[model samples]
Target: MEETRIRFGIMGCANIARKVSRAILLTPNTTISAIGSRSLEKAVVFASENHFPESTKVYGSYDAVLDDPDVDAVYVPLPTSLHVRWAVLAAEKKKHVLLEKPVALNVGELDTILAACDSNGVQFMDATMWMHHPRTVKMKQLLFDEQRFGQLKSVHSTLTFLAEEDFLKNDIRVNPNLDSLGALGDIGWYCIRAILWAHDYELPNIVTAFRDPEYHESGVILSCGASLNWKTNGKFATFYCSFLSNLCMDIIALGTKGNFRVHDFVIPFNEKVGSFYAVDNSKWAERALGCAPEPSELKIEINLPQEAFMVQEFGRLVAGVRSNEAKPENKWRVISRKTQLVIDAVVASIKNGFVPVEVVY
Candidate 1:
């Protein structure tokens, strides 16, 4: 039997859109049916380059794409500042949305978008590609397996990368309004998503945040870290995100009886998923499983690369979207809201010169 193909329209001609267009092409039950951009020339060029069917329509305005009854779903890769506005509009048009990260600048905006999706009965999500990766599932499993990382104690995480020089200026990262979200909001977000995933989407009871305003104008957070405590129990988590350093991404956790780590957090390849280190004692050992890393408490030097992580991960997200199985708990609105609340607390802490703010769930 032939499956129903989800007709997709792209809301921008951004480069990320090109990645998604390729993924859409790769997706089994999806099609890049239309594209809209501020400039028709750019839209036409992008659509043609991606080999979106010649019958696919190209429009100069986003509204035109939204108005296309044929577009059942929309992928919005717009700047962080515009996420809420367009997502709300798309939902009203009855088009499901796959929105990019930092879902919105604040919780208010995030709430508005979620509310709109609910009112309009459209599927909506923030594109935290990490959530879609198989490694994410594996990591969570290792955490709970009685044999590994039992009785988790503390978590430490870091995500940093050097942006390509040409991609720096006038980009969304540099725009003051859109730029209000820094490394934490931008990349550190993965850490929050990962942590929440490991904990079954439970919100931490206490959250304290800190931001480096000097590194960004518009009071954007440059380097933000949070110490989270779950009220129901005595579990604690700490996460760090930075933009002003060398390119390294990883997470390490210590449990009462074991330890676990993730070498490359962003986009780990299939082969790198289980590569990790573990110890029941205060000693070190390194071993590699050629096919896939062995399950252990401490996962380290997991050699997963960039495109391998995000591309296939996004493909899974698209698949979930097509199947109508995308959940609200995993929605970007929920993740971003938790993250923004963390950032808001961080900024308050930093403003008082690093005094900890009480994190409210």
Candidate 2:
């Protein structure tokens, strides 16, 4: 078989796309063939600044990009609500899709996109860049070991950020229609993903949650918490996330035998490494890794930019598609379903006054 270079056409000039576009540029095998935006002027400016070859098309509309027979795949960094809609349309156009996080507002919407991808024989993956991290897999290996956190007991995770003043002014994150799920959708999704990875817990049998209406002033949950109950064995875990709070990011999981913690789990900005700590025999003894010669004070510098990881990984995904190894065992559908399930329950719980909700599988 001939070596294939997955040609890409970016779907929007959104901020997220800026990161992804940079990533594509950094990676060697993937070629960005076109860029699209609602305005031709924006597309032209983006393409020109990025040094896209003259042959590369500057599309004024999404449909025009989709219509390009030369465009084999699309990177959609649109707003939260448009994820499912555009993903489905991209797949219908027979383009492989790498969509940003919170792939849909809910599971039902995710299902529709999944169906479209299946029908069109196109690969669709969620752009939860963190999920594809090398450290994530190693962390999962530790979590799955019975010797690690045997019989998970509880989970505590958080992610938050203060928006830059300039960004807060015009970003869609400030728009009610564009971001129905404020910080919860943006930051909370990672917390939920980490919890599941740590516990190896599938969909929770039951979930109950609450949103701070004060934080919900943006007409959405800026901060949210949820308690999850596992059906397989009645194992339970709790997760909390907020954008309204001061900067904080971490994931701590406690088990019957021991506890494991990850410092600054979400943002791997800079070359700062992330530390993973485990205490098995008891609370007194703690073993650390990822810092220096030894695991000392549960601190690891995760030195990487948010966009750097995603860019390289997207190249890998494109290669996988060409080689027919595109079927990743852990697809975004699982997390999307689990997250939407938890979010739906949380919404219900808040409306019903924090009453526990039994989630439908």
Candidate 3:
């Protein structure tokens, strides 16, 4: 039998890698070929615990996985600081790269990674699972309808989860030397991505960080909020991300004639089914006595989870490249760059005394 499935080598044993490993197995055209960690023993335990196939190789170093001839692609779940180094190495090895989000610490690093992928002719995609949810497509369709949604006016997104004491003190996200962007890089990435997706990836003209950003003693951001504005059309967006609040993921977009809301914009509350609410031409009746109609609840059901769908889409792209049928899909790369550019603007706004920062492309 010809081995047509894309074999993936995982470059880390982070907790999030477990979910992605399951996603790889669930995706039809993908398989977990290798698991790598600094400690070979840790890699072995991770593969066994994650129920990887017996043929999955365990390696002590990330470079070993990249050097493996059988690895057609690599999933990089490493820390933000390591993304550029390892992802670039993987691409240089001619392996497709599926990187986890907050793709990098800044746009400069992301561009470096993208350049490597382009030079090597390998697929590049950030692991933003929600982008693959069927519900997202449905919401986008509504947003594009001229009469149904009108012109986009404003968007507000929030994603916050209370971190445990131990995590607040020791998690990589709070470590300045590791995931230095902190909440903005971790949870805020999703919020930024959602806002961009709502706007069809249009780059905002200005970003202003909300005045009172919370920070850890280590100088890492613990919570923050920002407002984005489009000068040409006057469209605006606001997003808040924190590590000191109760779990919440919400995206509310208001248009001239309608509104749409998604309670779970990052990870759905239900793995198999996702939902959203939308309303068109909503109006009050009889001097604000009552509303004319309630928002419609739309549910999207899928055979596989969103992460698995992400893996499936990435695998298909890699397969296309392997068969010489198509080039690497650049859509995901473009989206990722735009998201990072907004994030960079937010960071600049925060650094420049909460002043508005102009987004440069």
Model 3 misplacement above 4 A? none
Error of 3 at 339 (Å): 0.8
lDDT for each residue of candidate 2 in 246-328, tens digit (9 for 90 to 100): 77778787777666777666655434454567666443333642332232334444445545565556556656765787653
Model 3's alpha-carbon lDDT is 0.94
Q: Write the per-residue lDDT of candidate 1 for residues 1-361, one digit (tens) a residue.
A: 1145677899998887887777666555567678999999999999988889887999999999999988878889998888888999998998888888777777778788888887876766666666655556666776776664677766777777765554355557755677567676787777776666666667776666644433654455556677777766578787777666666677776776566677766755343444545554443344532322344443334343333344444445545655678643355456657766665666566668776677665
Residue by residue across 21-138, what tens digits does model 3's lDDT show?
9999988899999988999999999999999999999999999999999999999999999999999999999999999989999999999999999999999999999999888899
Please tell me which predicted candidate would have the highest lDDT against the true structure: 3
Choose the strongest candidate by TM-score. 3
lDDT rank, highest first?
A: 3, 2, 1
Overall lDDT per candidate, in order of appearance? 0.69, 0.72, 0.94
Model 2: lowest-lDDT 10 consecutive positions: 288-297
Q: Candidate 1 at residue 228, lDDT? A: 76
TM-score winner between candidates 1 and 2? 2
| lDDT over C-alpha atoms for residue 88 of model 2 | 92
Model 2 TM-score (2 dp): 0.85
